[model samples]
Target: MHTQVAIIGAGPAGLLLSQLLQGAGIDCVVLERHDRAYVESRIRAGILEQITVDLLARVGVDARMRREGLPHDGFNLAVDGSTFRIDMTGLTAGSKVMVYGQTEVTHDLIEACLERNTPLVFEAQDVALHDIESDRPFVTFTKDGQARRLDCDFIAGCDGFHGVSRRSIPEERLAAFERVYPFGWLGILADVPPCGEELTYSNHERGFALASMRSPTRSRYYVQCGLDERLEDWPDERIWDELATRLGPEAASHMTRGPSIEKSIAPLRSFVCETMRHGRLFLAGDAAHIVPPTGAKGLNLAASDVAILSDALIRWYGEGEACGLDGYARRALARVWKAERFSWWFTGLTHRFPDMDSFARKMQLAELDYIRGSRAAQTTLAENYVGLPLA
Candidate 1:
């Protein structure tokens, strides 16, 4: 088979890219190692930056999101048993975020692709990229116990960090930067209303905690845990108790406790590849970068990457303009690094380091106090939180 673009993975990045490209009359094939059920059921961050929401609307997959997703003008930060709102909308001149699950976005994109008969192949295994450095690039994979080959003008590696795309580039061609944190987030999902109208990120002496929700009735809460902590060690009640303690008295006052519908511990990490493009093969989403979830930039960053990539690909095919494609890595990396900085900074400010002494704790509190008092600091946070304008 031959296509203008052979995309690996059916995650949000891959699916969105395919949808946008097809909307522009570009033909692409999406390959996923997992099945559709697995893709839609995987739990992920729920916050949608304005750009992500806009991109979904651009592809005509946002009707459900517009109707069901919660739009928030701001969020909260807690310290020393007190909380303050950031007022992202006010600070950023009416910019806001959408509280919509990534799973729902994926499902919507998948439905759009299927409705339009986009070539999205699930259960594709052993996907490999060939001759990526040359103009004539192709992909090989096994599907349904049969080997297949796909020739394409370009290859998009949206298969995530563990996928075969980035690794296909020679090691000498890529430089990797990463920091794995000492802690993980122990999170619980329950059918309970959130403690507050907006997400609350709390910094407690014990550890960090966050209050979030998938809907008005489904709350997701998290507390910092050691890397060695086990699920068996934290029951629903215990998790609720820790959340109450870390989130302080105010959030706990209206907090609802219930049986957890889902729970897991996810390690935090920040990773970025210096370049996003390798000849005819380009990497997007987790394949190119990963940020800590403190700022909720993972899925949004993926959206930004593909949004830029689709524009470049569209220009290349429509106008035969190679500038966008040639400058893809430089442009994408600029925004990627800025987001990395914000997520890293937010994580450091809220999370308790294992080796943090009294002085470090005091410093964190002082900075939080400064942010509370300074409009400049709040404006900076708001601008970033609302998602930077696309360049």
Candidate 2:
């Protein structure tokens, strides 16, 4: 098989890229290791920054999101038994976030791609990328236990953290920066209703807990835990109890138990690759960078990458300009580092650091108080939360 571009994942990044390219009359093929059902059902992020929502809308994939996704003007920060709300709408002049899971976004994008008759291969394995420096790079994979190859002009590596694209770059040419947090989030989705309207992020001696929702009928919550802890160790009762303690006394009564649809633990970390492109191969989304879920920046950042990449490719192909594509790494990293900093800040403020002395704890509390009291500080948080405009 031969195409203009070969996308190496069916997650949001790859799926959205294919749709965007198709809209611009570009041809591409997508390969996925997972089956279609698994790719569409996996539970992930649920917050969409304003820019993300706008981009999806522009791509004609926001119909279901517009109908079902909840819009929130702001979120709450709980500390010292008091809840402080940062009005995002007031801060950013009507900018707001929408609640829609990454899974749903993937489903929408995939459906759109299929309706447009775009090439998407599922259950593809043994995938390998080669000749990235050449004008014609290619991907080799196996389907139905048979070997096959896809020749392409460019390769978009959106296969995520465990994907092979990152490693395909020679070790000597790569420099990686990573920080693994001592804590992780034990997230759970229950059938019961949510306890609050907007998400509440609480910091306490017990740890950090976030009260979020998947829909009107479903509630999603997270509690801090050890990196190595297993889900089997956390029974339903234990999960609810921990949520209550961390969310504060007022939130205790509002919590209810129900059948859990999903439960898992995810370690917190900040990761970035020094460069995102190597000749014909360009990395996007989790394949390039990862941020802690504190600021809900993971999915938004991925969408931003594809938006920039798709536009750059359009410029290179449509107008015979290589300038945009040549500067892709520099342009993408500007927003990437800002999000990295915001995620780190939000994680540090909410999590209990192992090295946090009494003085450091006091300072953290002071900063939290100032954010709650000062409109300027709240505005800063709102802008970051709503996300910077897509470049």
Candidate 3:
């Protein structure tokens, strides 16, 4: 089999790239290790930056999102017990974000790809790349006991942080930096009304908590826990009690607890690769960087990465220009580092540290206080939260 681009991993990055490339009349095939149901059902982040929403709409896969997705103009930041709201839309010149689940976004893209008869191979096993440094590179994999080889001019490593894509690159040429926080987020998804219409992040003496939703009635909540904590340690009642305490009386009173549909513990980590491109293999999304979910930049950054990559590939295929491809690493890394900084800063601002001194605690509260009263500070946050420009 031969194609212009052979994409690994059918996650958002790969799926969205296929959609964009097809629109440009580029021939590509997507290889996914997981089946259809698993890819669409996995729970992930839901925050959509303005550019992400716009890109989805541009690709004609946001009809469901537009109908079901909630639009948020602001979000609440709580310190100790008092909460201050940041008006993202107002502060960022009418830019707003959409609160739509990432699973739903993937589902929409899958449906679009199916409807268009795009080439997306699922359940692909033992995928490996060869001759990536040469003009002709091909991928080999097994599907249903039969070995297969696909030839392509370029390869996109959209297979995520743990997938084979990043590992495929030579270690000496690629430098990776990572920081694992001492805490993890114990999260639960329940069929209950959310605490508020807008998302709220709270910092408390006990820890940190966030009240969010996939929809009006489907709530997703998270509370900070020690690195050693497990899902078994957090029952529904205890989780509810901790959320109520951390969110305080005003926000907690409105929170309705219910049976959890999903429960998991995700450790927070800040990671980034020194380079995103190695010869013909280019990394996007989790393959290139990871940010603490506090800032909601993971998927958005992926969308941005592929957007640059897609544009580059489109130029090469359509206009015969490869400058974007040559400059892909430099361009994507510039934005990736900014997101890394923001996620790290926001995570530190809200999470409780076991080794934090009294002075450090006081400083956290002081910064929160300043952020609440300072318009300049609020504007700076709004700009980052809504997302920086892709170019």
Across residues 1-391, which tens digit of lDDT does each residue of candidate 3 receive?
A: 9999999999999999999999999999999989999999999999999889988987899999999999999999988778889999899889989999999999999999999999999999999989877899899999998999999999999999998878888788888999999999999999999989999999999999999999999999999998788788888999999999999898888999998999999999999997788889999999889999999999999999999999999999888888989999888988899989999999999989989999999999999899999999999998999899865
lDDT, residue 260, candidate 2: 86
- Where's the lowest-lDDT run of ten residues in candidate 2? 248-257
The residue pairs that clash in candidate 2, if any, are: none
Clash statistics: count for each candidate: 0, 0, 0
263-363 in candidate 2: lDDT tens per residue?
99999899999669998999999999999999999999998999999999999889988998888888888999999999999999888887789999999
Off by over 4 Å in 2: none
- Candidate 2: give its CA RMSD in angstroms: 1.0
lDDT (C-alpha) at residue 25 in model 1: 99
At residue 337, give the lDDT of candidate 3: 91
When 2 and 3 are scored with TM-score, the better candidate is: 3
lDDT of 1 by residue, 1-391 (tens): 9999999999999999999999999999999999999999999999999999999999999999999999999999999579999999889888999999999999999999999999999999989899998989999999999999999999999999888999999999998899999999998999999998999999999999999999999999999999999999999999999999999999999899999989999999999997689899999999999999999999999999999999999999999999999989888888999999999999999989999999999999999999999999999999998888776
Candidate 2, position 140, lDDT: 98
Model 2 clash tally? 0
lDDT of 1 at 156: 94
